[model samples]
Target: MTITTPNNSFNATLQDLIEYPANGINSTVLLKDNNSQYSLFCLAAGTNIDEHTSTRNAVITVIEGSGNLNLEGKDIALTPGVFIFMPANAPHAVQAKENLAFTLALSEHLPAKKGVSQKTIDIVKSTAPVIKQHGKTITTRMYEIMFDTHPEVKSQFDMAAQANGTQHAKLATAVYSYATHIDDLESLKAMVDKIAHRHVATHVLPEQYPIVGECLLKAIKDVLGDAATEEVMTAWAEAYQALAGVFINREQQIYQNAS
Candidate 1:
């Protein structure tokens, strides 16, 4: 399912990079203009792209693969159809469990400046302090807490997880990532468009938005416990509403565009 728009410049071809040993990760740049960048990367089982940070926020979609994404400090399992937002200048890393392919899109419009890339071990030394102090890191913890406390929400993902399809995992990661990087309205819009398309594929009704909302609230409550202040919950809820609204609006636009 390749989507080429009149305004989109993304271009690339999937290739076999490894066979016997299934080692190393390779990337083929799809688009690299002044305003935006895109690429497809292939990785072999057990391969990794050690902890690294980017200057701009990146939206990553797992096209085909099994892997675990370490964002901030939490581990997120990723598979095909999953999307994850890597916030600007945030320390992140990847570990591939099987042959995998993924796509990444980054906006040049964000304000953050880039720092030098460090190896996986050296990464903590450079960015750990800031990540620990930053509020954004809490979201990763909240995700784990949410899943642990609200096992019912896990039911929403059972079918996919059982089949190793990572659609829900991707949506969750992308939503969290985009929420943390809301400085650019366009980035948010792109995130919405992606989510809308994903919903169409999964037959996800608009009503599922509330289910996700409740799961998020539960996660926050579990993570922060008594400290889950009203102000904090409200802010997160507002972000969720905005993101869901984008999904709904874009879904409508997609129908209109088709007609």
Candidate 2:
């Protein structure tokens, strides 16, 4: 059975999502409308949820059995009809003494930020296949546009190396590496650090980033042509900004430390 709201979203019953003896620790979402979410959790005896925190305020309604909920380093008794209100970012955990069931309701709260968002991650991931196919061409085009349009910025280039095509090849490899590892940036820390150091040595300035970004994005549009729709271009722009943030932040620190 379904209960549809005016917005076309529907309500879900907990019983419909799970049963007693879910046999182990089990959970299912009952509703997810905008900033509100509902989840059902069932745990067997001796089962537990380790400590964690939420970025949104949450409510827990115990439906059956008994448990001890550890909240902010303190344990609280939990039984049928017991309700727990947890403020955003609170550390909590649960342990089941017997078969236990509960409903978790999360209320709207300020959207919390940690790092680059999931949307951007997906956008970058979607481009990985296309990037893999045209990475070298895109980078080579980016250099041509950059050098041709901004000849004054050519002091940073090694003309002989660019002519030999090694520079474009290196830039292409770096761009592809970043696209593949966008989700796990920590893995690229050493390489990012090396790039930052080289940029600092080469007198790369913050103001010049936009120029490179424009050329690179246009180059992508040129190389991929019809495949680089506005959405794809927008996503690549965001990805570039995210990576530029990393590079710029590090370069700032390097410049500061040197001074």
Candidate 3:
């Protein structure tokens, strides 16, 4: 994974940390320490890390690829934009079944809430499509609605999309897998931070979040039809808050952890 920070600020860019080569099972960085008290990582495709435990609670986010995470004997397949948390000393391992990029945040010093457990809630399961045959049509409609209604954000995405190249397609596939398991709140937080950090570097405004959120909802409704209930929207809103909270916490932590 390539790391670029604009003017050496706290913002960091990760260009396909965990990646798969053409016809080669993907693999990338598993870990790195940047002297910021938090270690980062990018795991490559088809590479597997043996079961191990860390002294620091580690948060992992899939920024661009796909993989499977084995925590305490359970397997969780991960796609782009998915987040997973392993509390300190929790035994876990990761494997890239396909090309995948991942980020990990591990801090040696962090305030603790006593009695909290590190065991993660595993949510990767196979399910039938929400709609039998109309999934793509609905998804497209929602995407169109989102871009058409929010022209400014559309411009931002359009640029990214244009420059996305092959990387963009891979990222989209990964994100599809992630949206399936968005119920994990901590994981959501990690995904949010990863996105915010990336977008902030690209000059995306904070105000665009609601617009993005609304677009996502429209997509959900369009795809799920009547299945996209009010509760679903509420859940998504809470997830967004969880994601935003991580950013706020990180900004504060940067100041407090400054040299």
Model 2 ranges off by over 4 Å: 1-114
Q: Using Cα atoms with residue i matched to residue i, what is each candidate's TM-score against the true structure?
A: 0.38, 0.55, 0.37
lDDT of each residue in 1-259, candidate 3, tens digit only: 4343223445436672333455434333334343223334455456777766654567887776677899878888788788888875466887877666666776643332232122211211121244224444444555567668856655555555544344344334334544454444455556655655666555553334445556656776667666666755555444433343445345445434542
Say which candidate scores most in lDDT: 2
Model 3 scores worst on lDDT over the 10 consecutive residues at 119-128
Supply the global lDDT for candidate 2. 0.79
User: Ten residues in a row with the worst lDDT in model 1?
Assistant: 112-121
Whole-model lDDT, candidate 3?
Answer: 0.52
Candidate 1: the clashing residue pairs are 83-170
User: How many clashes does each candidate structure show, in the order listed?
Assistant: 1, 0, 13
On TM-score, the stronger of 2 and 3 is 2
Model 1 residue 9 lDDT score: 56
Whole-model Cα lDDT of every candidate shown, in order: 0.60, 0.79, 0.52
| TM-score attained by model 2 | 0.55
* Residue 11, candidate 3: C-alpha displacement in angstroms: 33
The number of residue pairs in model 3 that clash at the backbone is 13
